[model samples]
Target: MNSNQKKLVKSTVPVLQTNGTDLTKHFYSRMFKHHPELKNLFNMSNQASGKQQHALAGAVLAYAEHIENPEVLINVLKSIGNKHVSLNISPEQYDIVGHHLISSIKEVLGEAASDDLIEAWTEAYNELAQIMISIEAELYQSNLKKEGGWKGWRTFIISEITEESSEVKSFYLKPKDQASIADYLPGQYLSVKLFIPALGHEQARQYSLSSAFNPEYYRISVKKESNGNVPEGVVSNMLHHKKTGDEIWVSAPSGVFHAGVESNQPLVLISGGIGITPLLSMLETNKKRLQENTTVWLHSCRNEKVHAFKDNVDRLNQDSEWLTTHVFYETLSQNGNDSVKEGRINLAELRDEVLIDDAKYYICGPEVFIKVQYDSLIKLGVAQEDILYEEFGPQLLHFN
Candidate 1:
């Protein structure tokens, strides 16, 4: 964009800072009204909780704040673009979104939406859209060229459903066409799409692969998210209700959060609650290569009843001395349980066990858990580059 357009975009930063969420909320409502079919592609649960709106609002504010140097937003754009590829977002839809977004800006601003301002925003939106399209095109091509990968959604048959815990269930999925499955990185996730009867539309949710990569099948363990007060999880509840011999749609695994399999650095895996999914994959993948300086897994959950994959961790421990594990339960049913600690996994308390020199740490959990662990690690003198974290939803963390 030209200098005048940049100035126009920058001038809206104040308005966006104060009214971004309202604008995005209105934008989504208007866009969905005109393009109802797109409902199938969105996570209705996030929409209901207003997380999606909050995420988009943050993105808009970030864009306006960095309008003069858009390259500064490259990481954010790459993260979003990878997700878009997993969702099979097409280029044509960009036009629809741009039209609605600009229209929403006009509608929200009312008389303040001058022609010059709208024109500048139009150019800015087009530029961002093109960047996304180019990035997604490259991602699609790369995934398509992989040996067992395909673009868009592929049919998968659930061959088995193993109840792992009171709240989590593991589904063993095999390609219905009997095609070989792609080998995904240990920390990667796959998008699963299914029809929600209540919503009368399909909804897609990303679930981390919970086990090591297998050529024959892929495994995803889902924690049912119904806690009475919170809205019922459409996809998680549906997956829990499903039985053997059921079918679902799955996209190729895609995620930037991953452990370096070839690196010999000491690995620290910290997880809380249901966040253990992807970290479990990384641990399982490294099981065979465990040495004295292998991987360490520190996990925390509500109690033994909700703890998943205990047997798997035990069996892995028996195989090699490389996998060291420490389990913490917030509310243990038995006080004398020798195997588990009765408290949250506090990094400060376990500084000796963790904080190894030259260790690469991977954490996954709720926002609070991630922030706590990240801050603790930083306080313990760990480099920011050495700490990797994965959030279930949008990329909201901005590291300095």
Candidate 2:
């Protein structure tokens, strides 16, 4: 873009910071109305809760603030690109999104909107879209080039289903063609798309792989979100209701959150509630391949009834000589008994148990919990580079 266009986009930074989510909310509604088929691509649950809008708002504001040096946002771009590739987002959809976004800006700003401002925004959107499309294309090409991999979605049959907990179940999915599946770095997630009859549309949701990468099958442990009256988690609930022998569409594992297999540093895996899925994969993979590395799993949940993989972790602990596991229950059981420590998983409380000073910490959980765990680890003298965490939805990370 020219200097004048850049200036126009920069001037709108304040407005976007203040009203970006509102604009994106309007944009999504308009797009979905005009292009109902897109409902299959987007997570309506996230849309309803405003997470998708908030995420877009953050990205837009960031782009506007860094328009002159777009490379500064390369990390964010890579993260979004990975997700887009997992969702099979194509470059052609950029035009559809741009059209609605511009319309939303015009509708939201009303008389305050100007032709020059809209034109400048159009250019900016195109530029950003091109960058994202290019990155996504690279990711797609890389994934397709991997052994036993293909582009777009593949059919996977649910060969087995195991109830891990009252709210969580593990679905063992194998390729429908009985072919080998591409291997993924431990801690990555799979994007599963299924048709939801209630919404009258197909929906895609990313579920962290709960086990180590295997050519035979992938395991995703889903926590059914059926609390209260909120209609969110439509796909998760659908998966919970599904049985073995059902076929589901799945994308190759994708995400930047994973342990570095090459690193020989001690590994610390911390998780809360169902967020343990990806971390479990990391722990399992570490045990299988990197047995020499010292590993510890620190987890928190409501209680035994809700803890998903206690038996699995117990088996790993018994088999591995260098592994230690700790569980923190939020509340006691019905019998008011507890075998592990009581209360939330606080890093400070377990400082003595943290044997390694320069260990790599991997965390996954709710937004607030992840932030707390990250900050706590920092306070414990862990270098920022040694700590990594993944937020399930739109990343709101502000790396210091």
- Identify the candidate with maximal lDDT: 1
User: In model 1, what lDDT does residue 213 have?
Assistant: 89
- Number of the predicted model whose TM-score against the real structure is largest: 1
Query: Model 1: residues >4 Å from true position, as ranges?
Result: 227-231, 289-293
State the number of backbone clashes in model 2.
0
Clashes of each: 0, 0
lDDT per residue as tens, model 2, 118-189 = 999999999999999989888988988899887889999999999999899999999998988889988999
Q: For every model shown, what is its TM-score relative to the native structure?
A: 0.96, 0.95
Candidate 2 residue-wise lDDT at 73: 90
lDDT tens digits, residue span 325-376, model 1: 8999988884457888998888988899898888999999988889999999
Residue pairs clashing, model 1: none
